[model samples]
Target: MFDVNARIGHWPYRPVGTVDDLLKNMDALGISCACVSSLDAIHFLNPQDGNDSLARAIAPHRDRLVPLAVVRPEFAGWQDDLTRCLESHGMRGVVLYPNYHLYDLDDPEATELGARCSEAQIPVFVQVGLEDARRQFGRTIVPDVSLESVGAFGREHPSLKLVALGLKFGQPDQLRQPLPKNFYFDTSNYERLGDLEFAVSHFGVDRILFGTCAPLFHPRANADKLRCADLTAEQREAIGQGNARALFGL
Candidate 1:
Protein backbone atom coordinates (compact mmCIF):
# COMPACT_ATOMS: atom_id res chain seq x y z
CA MET A 1 0.00 0.00 0.00
CA PHE A 2 1.06 3.59 -0.56
CA ASP A 3 0.99 5.97 2.40
CA VAL A 4 0.29 9.50 1.20
CA ASN A 5 1.29 11.03 4.53
CA ALA A 6 4.38 10.05 6.54
CA ARG A 7 7.37 11.86 8.09
CA ILE A 8 11.10 11.39 8.76
CA GLY A 9 13.28 13.49 11.09
CA HIS A 10 13.08 14.71 14.67
CA TRP A 11 9.77 15.79 16.20
CA PRO A 12 10.88 17.62 19.31
CA TYR A 13 7.85 16.54 21.32
CA ARG A 14 8.10 12.85 20.41
CA PRO A 15 10.52 10.11 19.46
CA VAL A 16 10.32 10.17 15.64
CA GLY A 17 12.70 7.46 14.51
CA THR A 18 15.18 7.34 11.63
CA VAL A 19 14.49 6.32 8.04
CA ASP A 20 15.41 2.69 8.89
CA ASP A 21 12.83 2.64 11.64
CA LEU A 22 10.28 4.18 9.30
CA LEU A 23 11.02 1.43 6.77
CA LYS A 24 10.68 -1.27 9.41
CA ASN A 25 7.37 0.17 10.53
CA MET A 26 6.11 0.29 6.97
CA ASP A 27 7.22 -3.31 6.42
CA ALA A 28 5.49 -4.37 9.61
CA LEU A 29 2.27 -2.74 8.48
CA GLY A 30 2.50 -4.26 4.98
CA ILE A 31 2.88 -0.82 3.43
CA SER A 32 5.00 -1.09 0.25
CA CYS A 33 5.76 2.61 -0.20
CA ALA A 34 5.22 5.98 1.48
CA CYS A 35 5.41 9.68 0.57
CA VAL A 36 7.62 11.21 3.22
CA SER A 37 8.47 14.79 4.28
CA SER A 38 10.88 16.22 6.78
CA LEU A 39 9.48 16.88 10.27
CA ASP A 40 12.42 19.17 11.00
CA ALA A 41 11.34 21.39 8.13
CA ILE A 42 8.28 22.52 10.09
CA HIS A 43 10.35 24.35 12.69
CA PHE A 44 13.63 25.06 10.93
CA LEU A 45 14.83 28.61 10.28
CA ASN A 46 15.88 27.43 6.83
CA PRO A 47 13.51 24.63 5.91
CA GLN A 48 15.62 23.65 2.89
CA ASP A 49 18.21 22.27 5.28
CA GLY A 50 15.64 19.80 6.48
CA ASN A 51 14.70 19.01 2.90
CA ASP A 52 18.35 18.37 2.10
CA SER A 53 18.64 16.06 5.09
CA LEU A 54 15.57 14.14 3.91
CA ALA A 55 16.91 13.89 0.36
CA ARG A 56 20.23 12.40 1.53
CA ALA A 57 18.58 10.01 3.99
CA ILE A 58 16.07 8.68 1.47
CA ALA A 59 18.64 8.44 -1.36
CA PRO A 60 19.23 4.70 -0.92
CA HIS A 61 15.47 3.94 -0.73
CA ARG A 62 14.06 6.22 -3.41
CA ASP A 63 12.11 3.33 -4.86
CA ARG A 64 10.14 2.93 -1.62
CA LEU A 65 10.28 6.41 -0.11
CA VAL A 66 9.03 9.32 -2.18
CA PRO A 67 10.39 12.63 -0.95
CA LEU A 68 8.13 15.71 -0.61
CA ALA A 69 9.97 18.95 0.01
CA VAL A 70 8.64 21.28 2.69
CA VAL A 71 8.42 24.83 1.34
CA ARG A 72 7.70 28.02 3.29
CA PRO A 73 6.50 30.40 0.62
CA GLU A 74 6.79 33.39 2.95
CA PHE A 75 10.54 32.95 3.34
CA ALA A 76 13.09 34.75 1.18
CA GLY A 77 14.79 32.75 -1.62
CA TRP A 78 11.80 30.41 -1.53
CA GLN A 79 11.56 30.52 -5.34
CA ASP A 80 15.08 29.15 -5.69
CA ASP A 81 14.40 26.60 -2.96
CA LEU A 82 11.33 25.36 -4.79
CA THR A 83 13.29 25.05 -8.02
CA ARG A 84 16.13 23.15 -6.31
CA CYS A 85 13.67 20.86 -4.54
CA LEU A 86 11.97 19.93 -7.79
CA GLU A 87 15.16 19.71 -9.94
CA SER A 88 18.10 18.76 -7.70
CA HIS A 89 16.31 16.73 -4.99
CA GLY A 90 13.88 15.19 -7.45
CA MET A 91 11.02 15.64 -5.00
CA ARG A 92 7.69 14.30 -6.21
CA GLY A 93 5.66 16.97 -4.39
CA VAL A 94 5.78 19.87 -1.94
CA VAL A 95 4.31 20.00 1.58
CA LEU A 96 3.13 23.31 3.02
CA TYR A 97 2.82 24.23 6.71
CA PRO A 98 0.94 27.53 6.76
CA ASN A 99 0.14 27.25 10.45
CA TYR A 100 3.70 26.79 11.62
CA HIS A 101 5.07 29.08 8.97
CA LEU A 102 2.64 31.83 10.05
CA TYR A 103 0.93 32.56 6.73
CA ASP A 104 -2.65 32.42 5.58
CA LEU A 105 -3.55 30.28 2.59
CA ASP A 106 -4.70 33.39 0.72
CA ASP A 107 -1.37 35.16 1.12
CA PRO A 108 0.14 36.39 -2.17
CA GLU A 109 3.31 34.36 -1.68
CA ALA A 110 1.22 31.22 -1.19
CA THR A 111 -0.81 32.08 -4.28
CA GLU A 112 2.34 32.48 -6.38
CA LEU A 113 3.76 29.21 -5.06
CA GLY A 114 0.51 27.41 -5.76
CA ALA A 115 0.44 28.78 -9.27
CA ARG A 116 4.02 27.65 -9.83
CA CYS A 117 3.37 24.13 -8.55
CA SER A 118 0.25 23.96 -10.70
CA GLU A 119 2.33 24.96 -13.69
CA ALA A 120 4.91 22.30 -12.78
CA GLN A 121 2.13 19.67 -12.47
CA ILE A 122 3.22 18.69 -8.97
CA PRO A 123 0.90 18.04 -6.06
CA VAL A 124 0.98 20.36 -3.05
CA PHE A 125 0.26 18.70 0.29
CA VAL A 126 -1.09 21.02 2.96
CA GLN A 127 -0.69 19.94 6.57
CA VAL A 128 -3.97 20.84 8.22
CA GLY A 129 -2.93 19.72 11.66
CA LEU A 130 0.18 18.00 12.98
CA GLU A 131 -1.15 17.30 16.48
CA ASP A 132 -4.53 17.35 18.10
CA ALA A 133 -5.32 20.78 19.47
CA ARG A 134 -6.46 19.41 22.82
CA ARG A 135 -3.13 17.68 23.34
CA GLN A 136 -0.88 20.45 22.08
CA PHE A 137 1.77 21.91 24.36
CA GLY A 138 0.50 24.90 26.33
CA ARG A 139 3.41 27.15 25.49
CA THR A 140 3.92 26.16 21.87
CA ILE A 141 0.49 25.35 20.57
CA VAL A 142 0.04 25.54 16.79
CA PRO A 143 -3.45 25.98 15.45
CA ASP A 144 -4.63 23.97 12.47
CA VAL A 145 -5.13 25.60 9.07
CA SER A 146 -8.84 26.05 8.72
CA LEU A 147 -10.72 24.00 6.14
CA GLU A 148 -12.56 27.14 5.03
CA SER A 149 -9.23 28.67 4.07
CA VAL A 150 -8.26 25.50 2.25
CA GLY A 151 -11.51 25.56 0.33
CA ALA A 152 -10.90 29.20 -0.59
CA PHE A 153 -7.40 28.42 -1.76
CA GLY A 154 -8.75 25.60 -3.93
CA ARG A 155 -11.37 27.92 -5.42
CA GLU A 156 -8.72 30.50 -6.29
CA HIS A 157 -6.32 27.99 -7.82
CA PRO A 158 -8.60 25.57 -9.60
CA SER A 159 -5.80 23.78 -11.43
CA LEU A 160 -3.52 23.08 -8.47
CA LYS A 161 -3.49 19.52 -7.19
CA LEU A 162 -4.07 19.86 -3.44
CA VAL A 163 -3.99 17.22 -0.74
CA ALA A 164 -4.91 18.10 2.83
CA LEU A 165 -3.37 15.98 5.59
CA GLY A 166 -4.26 15.58 9.31
CA LEU A 167 -7.97 16.34 8.97
CA LYS A 168 -10.57 14.56 11.07
CA PHE A 169 -13.42 12.61 9.44
CA GLY A 170 -16.07 15.36 9.59
CA GLN A 171 -13.87 18.38 9.14
CA PRO A 172 -14.23 18.67 5.39
CA ASP A 173 -18.00 18.65 5.63
CA GLN A 174 -17.78 21.82 7.67
CA LEU A 175 -17.14 23.71 4.46
CA ARG A 176 -20.37 25.18 3.12
CA GLN A 177 -19.26 24.96 -0.51
CA PRO A 178 -17.61 22.14 -2.42
CA LEU A 179 -13.85 22.04 -2.88
CA PRO A 180 -12.27 21.88 -6.31
CA LYS A 181 -12.05 18.63 -8.28
CA ASN A 182 -8.26 18.63 -7.95
CA PHE A 183 -8.43 18.73 -4.15
CA TYR A 184 -7.73 15.50 -2.21
CA PHE A 185 -7.31 14.27 1.36
CA ASP A 186 -5.35 11.62 3.28
CA THR A 187 -6.81 9.15 5.78
CA SER A 188 -4.67 9.61 8.87
CA ASN A 189 -6.76 11.49 11.44
CA TYR A 190 -10.02 9.78 10.50
CA GLU A 191 -11.10 7.84 13.60
CA ARG A 192 -14.85 7.76 14.01
CA LEU A 193 -16.96 4.74 13.08
CA GLY A 194 -17.82 4.67 9.36
CA ASP A 195 -15.40 7.54 8.76
CA LEU A 196 -13.86 5.92 5.70
CA GLU A 197 -17.25 5.17 4.24
CA PHE A 198 -18.38 8.70 4.99
CA ALA A 199 -15.33 10.07 3.25
CA VAL A 200 -15.86 7.87 0.19
CA SER A 201 -19.52 8.78 -0.09
CA HIS A 202 -18.95 12.45 0.60
CA PHE A 203 -15.75 13.11 -1.34
CA GLY A 204 -15.78 10.21 -3.82
CA VAL A 205 -13.43 7.24 -3.61
CA ASP A 206 -10.90 8.71 -6.04
CA ARG A 207 -10.15 11.63 -3.72
CA ILE A 208 -9.40 9.53 -0.65
CA LEU A 209 -5.83 8.21 -0.21
CA PHE A 210 -4.45 5.89 2.44
CA GLY A 211 -2.12 7.64 4.86
CA THR A 212 -0.39 6.67 8.07
CA CYS A 213 0.82 9.62 10.15
CA ALA A 214 3.51 7.23 11.16
CA PRO A 215 6.34 7.54 13.72
CA LEU A 216 4.11 10.19 15.40
CA PHE A 217 0.90 8.16 15.46
CA HIS A 218 0.93 4.35 15.34
CA PRO A 219 1.03 3.09 11.77
CA ARG A 220 -0.90 -0.07 12.65
CA ALA A 221 -3.89 1.87 13.93
CA ASN A 222 -4.28 3.80 10.70
CA ALA A 223 -3.81 0.63 8.68
CA ASP A 224 -6.49 -1.07 10.74
CA LYS A 225 -8.92 1.71 9.86
CA LEU A 226 -8.59 0.80 6.19
CA ARG A 227 -8.72 -2.95 6.88
CA CYS A 228 -11.84 -2.67 9.01
CA ALA A 229 -13.75 -0.17 6.89
CA ASP A 230 -16.81 -1.57 5.05
CA LEU A 231 -15.55 -0.95 1.53
CA THR A 232 -15.51 -3.25 -1.48
CA ALA A 233 -12.21 -4.76 -2.62
CA GLU A 234 -11.93 -2.35 -5.53
CA GLN A 235 -12.79 0.64 -3.36
CA ARG A 236 -10.33 -0.48 -0.70
CA GLU A 237 -7.60 -1.04 -3.28
CA ALA A 238 -8.17 2.39 -4.76
CA ILE A 239 -7.86 4.14 -1.43
CA GLY A 240 -5.05 1.93 -0.16
CA GLN A 241 -2.66 2.29 -3.07
CA GLY A 242 -4.26 2.87 -6.45
CA ASN A 243 -5.26 6.45 -5.81
CA ALA A 244 -1.82 7.41 -4.56
CA ARG A 245 -0.15 5.65 -7.46
CA ALA A 246 -2.28 7.54 -9.95
CA LEU A 247 -1.89 10.85 -8.11
CA PHE A 248 1.87 10.61 -7.75
CA GLY A 249 2.46 8.61 -10.95
CA LEU A 250 4.21 5.83 -9.06
Candidate 2:
Protein backbone atom coordinates (compact mmCIF):
# COMPACT_ATOMS: atom_id res chain seq x y z
CA MET A 1 0.00 0.00 0.00
CA PHE A 2 1.10 3.59 -0.64
CA ASP A 3 0.29 5.82 2.31
CA VAL A 4 -0.97 9.22 1.11
CA ASN A 5 -0.16 10.99 4.38
CA ALA A 6 2.73 10.46 6.80
CA ARG A 7 5.38 12.54 8.61
CA ILE A 8 8.91 12.35 10.00
CA GLY A 9 10.89 14.44 12.50
CA HIS A 10 10.30 15.35 16.12
CA TRP A 11 6.89 16.62 17.15
CA PRO A 12 6.58 18.73 20.28
CA TYR A 13 3.36 17.10 21.42
CA ARG A 14 4.55 13.49 21.19
CA PRO A 15 7.38 11.19 20.29
CA VAL A 16 7.64 10.44 16.54
CA GLY A 17 10.59 8.05 16.86
CA THR A 18 13.07 7.88 13.94
CA VAL A 19 12.96 7.39 10.20
CA ASP A 20 13.94 3.76 10.74
CA ASP A 21 11.03 3.38 13.15
CA LEU A 22 8.65 4.73 10.54
CA LEU A 23 10.01 2.39 7.87
CA LYS A 24 9.84 -0.58 10.23
CA ASN A 25 6.25 0.22 11.11
CA MET A 26 5.39 0.45 7.43
CA ASP A 27 7.05 -2.85 6.76
CA ALA A 28 5.09 -4.50 9.54
CA LEU A 29 1.86 -3.05 8.21
CA GLY A 30 2.60 -4.01 4.58
CA ILE A 31 2.78 -0.37 3.58
CA SER A 32 5.09 -0.35 0.57
CA CYS A 33 5.58 3.40 0.34
CA ALA A 34 4.61 6.66 2.03
CA CYS A 35 4.67 10.28 0.89
CA VAL A 36 6.31 11.86 3.91
CA SER A 37 6.83 15.46 4.99
CA SER A 38 8.92 16.89 7.78
CA LEU A 39 7.16 17.93 10.98
CA ASP A 40 10.10 20.23 11.72
CA ALA A 41 8.94 22.54 8.97
CA ILE A 42 5.49 23.01 10.46
CA HIS A 43 6.63 25.61 12.98
CA PHE A 44 10.33 26.03 12.33
CA LEU A 45 12.01 29.42 12.02
CA ASN A 46 13.96 28.24 8.98
CA PRO A 47 11.66 26.11 6.86
CA GLN A 48 14.49 24.96 4.62
CA ASP A 49 16.04 23.14 7.54
CA GLY A 50 13.10 20.74 7.61
CA ASN A 51 13.10 20.24 3.84
CA ASP A 52 16.86 19.69 3.85
CA SER A 53 16.56 17.11 6.61
CA LEU A 54 13.78 15.29 4.80
CA ALA A 55 15.78 15.13 1.56
CA ARG A 56 18.78 13.81 3.47
CA ALA A 57 16.82 11.24 5.46
CA ILE A 58 15.00 9.80 2.45
CA ALA A 59 18.11 9.68 0.25
CA PRO A 60 18.92 6.03 1.01
CA HIS A 61 15.26 4.95 1.16
CA ARG A 62 13.83 6.46 -1.98
CA ASP A 63 12.15 3.22 -2.98
CA ARG A 64 9.91 3.22 0.07
CA LEU A 65 9.56 6.94 0.77
CA VAL A 66 8.71 9.94 -1.36
CA PRO A 67 9.47 13.39 0.00
CA LEU A 68 6.69 15.99 0.28
CA ALA A 69 8.13 19.46 0.63
CA VAL A 70 6.52 21.92 3.05
CA VAL A 71 6.19 25.57 2.05
CA ARG A 72 4.94 28.76 3.67
CA PRO A 73 2.66 30.48 1.19
CA GLU A 74 3.28 33.99 2.51
CA PHE A 75 7.07 33.84 2.45
CA ALA A 76 9.02 35.46 -0.35
CA GLY A 77 11.05 33.05 -2.47
CA TRP A 78 8.95 30.09 -1.36
CA GLN A 79 8.39 29.40 -5.02
CA ASP A 80 12.14 28.94 -5.41
CA ASP A 81 12.16 26.47 -2.53
CA LEU A 82 9.31 24.50 -4.08
CA THR A 83 11.10 24.50 -7.42
CA ARG A 84 14.22 23.09 -5.80
CA CYS A 85 12.15 20.42 -4.09
CA LEU A 86 10.66 19.40 -7.44
CA GLU A 87 13.55 19.93 -9.89
CA SER A 88 16.31 18.89 -7.48
CA HIS A 89 14.83 16.53 -4.89
CA GLY A 90 12.12 15.02 -7.08
CA MET A 91 9.48 15.48 -4.40
CA ARG A 92 6.00 14.35 -5.48
CA GLY A 93 4.00 16.96 -3.57
CA VAL A 94 3.93 19.84 -1.05
CA VAL A 95 2.14 20.08 2.33
CA LEU A 96 0.69 23.26 3.83
CA TYR A 97 0.18 23.72 7.58
CA PRO A 98 -2.16 26.68 7.61
CA ASN A 99 -2.85 26.87 11.32
CA TYR A 100 0.74 26.35 12.35
CA HIS A 101 1.91 28.79 9.67
CA LEU A 102 -0.83 31.30 10.57
CA TYR A 103 -2.19 31.68 7.04
CA ASP A 104 -5.65 31.23 5.57
CA LEU A 105 -6.65 29.56 2.32
CA ASP A 106 -8.25 32.86 1.23
CA ASP A 107 -4.92 34.69 1.45
CA PRO A 108 -3.86 36.03 -1.96
CA GLU A 109 -0.38 34.54 -1.64
CA ALA A 110 -1.89 31.16 -0.91
CA THR A 111 -4.11 31.41 -3.98
CA GLU A 112 -1.10 32.27 -6.16
CA LEU A 113 0.85 29.42 -4.65
CA GLY A 114 -2.02 27.06 -5.39
CA ALA A 115 -2.06 28.29 -8.97
CA ARG A 116 1.67 27.68 -9.33
CA CYS A 117 1.28 24.16 -7.99
CA SER A 118 -1.62 23.54 -10.34
CA GLU A 119 0.44 24.66 -13.32
CA ALA A 120 3.35 22.50 -12.20
CA GLN A 121 1.03 19.48 -11.94
CA ILE A 122 2.13 18.87 -8.39
CA PRO A 123 -0.33 17.68 -5.73
CA VAL A 124 -0.94 19.73 -2.60
CA PHE A 125 -1.66 18.17 0.84
CA VAL A 126 -3.45 20.36 3.35
CA GLN A 127 -3.25 19.30 6.98
CA VAL A 128 -6.29 20.26 9.05
CA GLY A 129 -4.41 19.74 12.31
CA LEU A 130 -2.19 17.21 14.03
CA GLU A 131 -4.95 16.22 16.44
CA ASP A 132 -8.52 17.02 17.40
CA ALA A 133 -9.26 19.87 19.83
CA ARG A 134 -9.78 17.53 22.78
CA ARG A 135 -6.41 15.86 22.26
CA GLN A 136 -4.38 19.03 21.75
CA PHE A 137 -2.03 20.45 24.36
CA GLY A 138 -3.40 23.03 26.76
CA ARG A 139 -1.35 26.05 25.70
CA THR A 140 -1.51 25.23 22.00
CA ILE A 141 -4.97 25.66 20.58
CA VAL A 142 -4.24 25.34 16.90
CA PRO A 143 -7.15 25.96 14.55
CA ASP A 144 -8.10 24.10 11.40
CA VAL A 145 -8.89 25.25 7.88
CA SER A 146 -12.62 25.70 7.67
CA LEU A 147 -14.43 23.21 5.44
CA GLU A 148 -16.16 26.14 3.70
CA SER A 149 -12.79 27.60 2.80
CA VAL A 150 -11.64 24.20 1.56
CA GLY A 151 -14.71 23.84 -0.65
CA ALA A 152 -14.30 27.40 -1.88
CA PHE A 153 -10.63 26.98 -2.66
CA GLY A 154 -11.37 23.79 -4.51
CA ARG A 155 -13.98 25.56 -6.60
CA GLU A 156 -11.66 28.47 -7.35
CA HIS A 157 -8.83 26.25 -8.55
CA PRO A 158 -10.33 23.33 -10.38
CA SER A 159 -6.96 22.18 -11.67
CA LEU A 160 -5.40 21.97 -8.23
CA LYS A 161 -5.44 18.38 -6.97
CA LEU A 162 -6.33 19.04 -3.36
CA VAL A 163 -5.95 16.34 -0.70
CA ALA A 164 -7.47 17.03 2.68
CA LEU A 165 -5.83 15.10 5.52
CA GLY A 166 -7.72 14.78 8.81
CA LEU A 167 -10.97 15.88 7.16
CA LYS A 168 -14.03 14.35 8.82
CA PHE A 169 -17.67 15.20 8.21
CA GLY A 170 -20.14 14.33 10.94
CA GLN A 171 -23.23 14.03 8.77
CA PRO A 172 -23.77 11.84 5.72
CA ASP A 173 -25.37 14.65 3.74
CA GLN A 174 -22.17 16.71 3.96
CA LEU A 175 -20.40 13.99 2.02
CA ARG A 176 -22.38 14.89 -1.10
CA GLN A 177 -21.80 18.63 -0.75
CA PRO A 178 -19.89 20.54 -3.40
CA LEU A 179 -16.11 20.26 -3.18
CA PRO A 180 -13.25 20.65 -5.58
CA LYS A 181 -14.02 18.14 -8.31
CA ASN A 182 -10.44 16.94 -8.12
CA PHE A 183 -10.29 16.76 -4.34
CA TYR A 184 -9.50 13.57 -2.40
CA PHE A 185 -9.66 12.65 1.27
CA ASP A 186 -6.98 10.68 3.03
CA THR A 187 -8.32 7.70 5.02
CA SER A 188 -6.18 8.16 8.10
CA ASN A 189 -8.96 9.25 10.43
CA TYR A 190 -11.75 7.21 8.86
CA GLU A 191 -12.30 4.19 11.07
CA ARG A 192 -15.97 3.82 11.90
CA LEU A 193 -17.59 0.56 10.90
CA GLY A 194 -19.52 0.75 7.59
CA ASP A 195 -17.98 4.20 7.08
CA LEU A 196 -15.74 3.05 4.24
CA GLU A 197 -18.66 1.33 2.51
CA PHE A 198 -20.84 4.40 2.92
CA ALA A 199 -18.14 6.73 1.64
CA VAL A 200 -17.26 4.46 -1.25
CA SER A 201 -20.92 4.07 -2.06
CA HIS A 202 -21.51 7.82 -1.98
CA PHE A 203 -18.27 9.40 -3.21
CA GLY A 204 -16.84 6.49 -5.18
CA VAL A 205 -13.53 4.80 -4.38
CA ASP A 206 -11.57 7.15 -6.65
CA ARG A 207 -11.88 10.01 -4.14
CA ILE A 208 -10.46 8.03 -1.24
CA LEU A 209 -6.76 7.41 -0.65
CA PHE A 210 -5.05 5.15 1.86
CA GLY A 211 -3.25 7.05 4.63
CA THR A 212 -1.98 5.80 7.98
CA CYS A 213 -1.02 9.10 9.63
CA ALA A 214 1.70 6.95 11.19
CA PRO A 215 3.18 7.49 14.65
CA LEU A 216 0.43 9.99 15.38
CA PHE A 217 -1.97 7.12 14.58
CA HIS A 218 -1.06 3.50 14.26
CA PRO A 219 -0.39 2.30 10.72
CA ARG A 220 -1.45 -1.22 11.53
CA ALA A 221 -4.86 -0.17 12.80
CA ASN A 222 -5.59 1.99 9.78
CA ALA A 223 -4.38 -0.81 7.53
CA ASP A 224 -6.73 -3.18 9.27
CA LYS A 225 -9.63 -0.84 8.70
CA LEU A 226 -9.25 -1.04 4.92
CA ARG A 227 -8.26 -4.68 4.91
CA CYS A 228 -11.46 -5.49 6.76
CA ALA A 229 -13.77 -3.22 4.80
CA ASP A 230 -16.29 -5.09 2.62
CA LEU A 231 -15.10 -3.63 -0.63
CA THR A 232 -14.59 -5.03 -4.08
CA ALA A 233 -11.10 -5.90 -5.29
CA GLU A 234 -11.06 -2.86 -7.54
CA GLN A 235 -12.20 -0.58 -4.71
CA ARG A 236 -9.54 -2.01 -2.41
CA GLU A 237 -6.89 -1.55 -5.05
CA ALA A 238 -7.96 2.03 -5.70
CA ILE A 239 -7.90 2.98 -2.03
CA GLY A 240 -4.78 0.98 -1.33
CA GLN A 241 -2.51 2.56 -3.93
CA GLY A 242 -4.03 2.80 -7.38
CA ASN A 243 -5.55 6.23 -6.87
CA ALA A 244 -2.34 7.49 -5.30
CA ARG A 245 -0.24 6.23 -8.22
CA ALA A 246 -2.45 8.02 -10.71
CA LEU A 247 -2.96 11.17 -8.67
CA PHE A 248 0.70 11.54 -7.74
CA GLY A 249 2.13 10.15 -11.00
CA LEU A 250 4.12 7.63 -9.00
Off by over 4 Å in 1: none
RMSD of each: 1.0, 1.6
What's each prediction's TM-score?
Answer: 0.97, 0.95
Per-residue accuracy of model 2 over 140-198 as CA lDDT, tens digit each: 78876776777677777899899888776542234347545788888887657697898
How does model 2 fare in lDDT?
A: 0.84
Candidates' C-alpha lDDT: 0.90, 0.84
Task: Tell me the TM-score of model 2.
Answer: 0.95
Top model number, TM-score: 1
Q: Write down the worst ten-residue block by lDDT for model 2.
A: 170-179
Candidate 2: the clashing residue pairs are none
Per-residue alpha-carbon lDDT of candidate 1 for residues 1-250, written as tens digits (9 for 90 to 100): 9999999999878677788988998998899999999999988998999999999999999989999999999999999999999999999899999999999989999999999988999999999988988888789789889999998888788888899998887887865556578888889997798999988988899989899887788788889999999999999999999999999776
